[model samples]
Target: METDIVGVSEHRFDGGLLAATRRFEAAADVTREVGAGSVGVAHTLIALARMPGGVAAGLFARQGIPPDVLAAGLPGGGAGQASDAGAPRLGRLPVTAGLRAAFDAAAATARVDERVLLIALLARLEAGAVDLLAGYGRVDLDAWLTEVKAGRRVGDVFGPDGAIDPAAFGPGASRVLAVTVTEAGALGHERYGIALLLHALATTPGGLLEQAYLFLRRDVRALREQTLTLAGSRPRAGRGPAPERAPVPDEPVRQVL
Candidate 1:
């Protein structure tokens, strides 16, 4: 599909998710600030999820993805560097092809139907992600999104000048944009957000984003059966026959901030 990506000629899902993920990674690479470096998509999503009433944050909290855990993935606050104020600045990290592929899958799965990747993330339901959404009680995907988005619009994180200023993005802005823009693209029929969520799940692996996507896309009951069958086939941990391993439901569906 042809998309209207900013600062790019043709439509590319990478523009949305890739750009944001790279920015966050870049932020982590530099700025010796505490709770900041080696940032991952999961870390960024957790940051945005923490946004007031943010879907990802709520879900992450429910699934036991703590702030400290997310913080650990971020760069340090220049601990013990108070004396060396003349430290050289860090440079930006470039986006990778693997990240781009992940976003592509997510966008394709959502079929470019969603606007908010956060909403989509919650709705998707991968294993880890399901744990978070589980407490919500029989989620109505569309209704849930409406409630979360109530009276709000997608705001620009850019500064007054039409420039891609890294400073303005702040701490975990890279992660936040990763999901937010994809949401925008989903709504705008842009491929970026679709790609963003896709990429998030891949980077996160068994993390919340992947779980959420699995839950939303797959058949819950059938998956339960499959999970059980696989578990039963495994050898016991210590006993004659290890008790049948509980099947963790692996449903595939569809993310946000």
Candidate 2:
């Protein structure tokens, strides 16, 4: 599965679920610090699921596909252009097994359409839903990022520009460090991003309850927005776009592998 979902890796589904929840919560922690604004982590979770092929991958995996088969948008849709629900629609939208399950459920249960997910992320970030999780004093996000990037402790990473500069990390992990610790990037960066967000939220001006609600709002907003796009999904046949194969009430009719 490419998007964040509940059903990936029966072999490791439990572990994956726990990790994703932790990651999502951590990212939410960072978003909590902004103005008591109205953003929610549901928004981010759904957004991740609805990202282009993000939905497809999740559905494909949930329906039981091998790693190799996920390349097709639909399980039996075959190669190139003609995608099954598993193939990435356009461009390489990063998809992990956990992400796929999230989107699959979104597509199935929660009325999240998918495109709204993208729009939500874009809008919130553009809106600056929440600014930096925290500024430096003792253990800041920049400091946290730096520490993780540097592969050292927080105290060791304390230097100019806060978080360990990208140079501190090897080429692979460097780009994430360069982003300056965004809410979306939090989970993507592995444990470091999640930890920093958690630390920032844990030390918020408001209590933990208010902080958690802030994130919930952001998530809810993102999920709601995704419906706008997901409901509009359709199959296109060449020159002009085609009508959606499945409407809201219509059960999606797909071929099995």
Alpha-carbon lDDT, every model:
0.35, 0.29
Candidate with the greatest lDDT versus the true structure:
1
RMSD list, candidates in order: 22.8, 24.7
- Let me know the TM-score candidate 1 reaches against the reference structure: 0.27
How do the predictions measure up, each by TM-score? 0.27, 0.17
Give one digit per residue, the lDDT tens place, for model 1 in 15-124. 33334334234334432233433222333344344443334444445456664454443333211121123322223322222222223444554332112444444343
Q: List the candidate 1 regions with Cα displacement exceeding 4 Å.
A: 1-39, 73-91, 96-98, 109-257
Model 2 C-alpha lDDT per residue in residues 128-164, reported as the tens digit of each score: 1112112111213243324332343433333342334
- C-alpha displacement of 154 in model 2, angstroms? 37
| lDDT score at residue 7, model 2, on the 0-100 scale | 33
